[model samples]
Target: MGREIYFGQQELTLKLTGITRFFAIRRKVTMPYSTIKEVLVSDFEAPKWMIRAPGTSIAPLNIYEGSFNYGDEWYFLSFERKEPVVIITLEGHSKYRYVVFAMDNPTKTAAEIRRHLHEVV
Candidate 1:
């Protein structure tokens, strides 16, 4: 599937879709600005033991999407390491604690996300 992340005044939407519209596995995740706790630009590598149960990865296109769990923490990672990614930590999210995604300019994206977070507060 392909990916698109859009930031709005009150929420961020992550849209993922497979090849064609007919054969697409689309997932749209909407996150409220208030739910974000922290945003960090970091280098990420899936752990050796990590597994993506209901996920998809197209290595050639540099896409990796799915869930990774470590002890008490679970993370939803949809990253294409063509560039650096911004890790967004969440509050009271039962599914996953973090969301990691690549952006054209992660530093600026992180700053903008922080700005939205502060706006909500």
Candidate 2:
């Protein structure tokens, strides 16, 4: 039941499977790209309460990080989209040792990331 989600010029749609977490943002609504960009620019580091993951990690669906170090926290998965790279953890661990780090590409600079994010589809 796994199907691909597509994002092109002016279209966005989803084909549901048995499972899927918060990943791509549908273009159906006008999204605040600026806020996303801000988050992506500075939040992919390890937090202040880093700890071992409770279970084995899973690979991401795209060019993304499965884990990141913020300061003292650990994020399980990071979803790379056009605007930001969203971090993910277990459902109840949104704080402390488990949290998401919204980020842009690490290899690329912020300006480069913004350029990629605003590409004409």
Best by lDDT: 1
For residue 106, model 1's alpha carbon misses the true position, in angstroms, by 1.1
The residue-by-residue lDDT of candidate 1 on 2-119, one tens digit each, is 5566778778877766642112233766778767788899887655555565566665666667766766777777776666788888887757678887767779878887776777
Off by more than 4 A, model 1 = 8-10, 17-26, 57-63
Worst 10 residues of 1 by lDDT: 17-26
> What are the clash counts of all predictions, listed in order?
0, 14
lDDT of each: 0.69, 0.33
User: Residue-wise lDDT of candidate 2 within 1-121, one digit each (tens)?
Assistant: 1223334444222232222222311111122232232323434433334333432223342323234445665444333333443322232333323323233243243454345447732
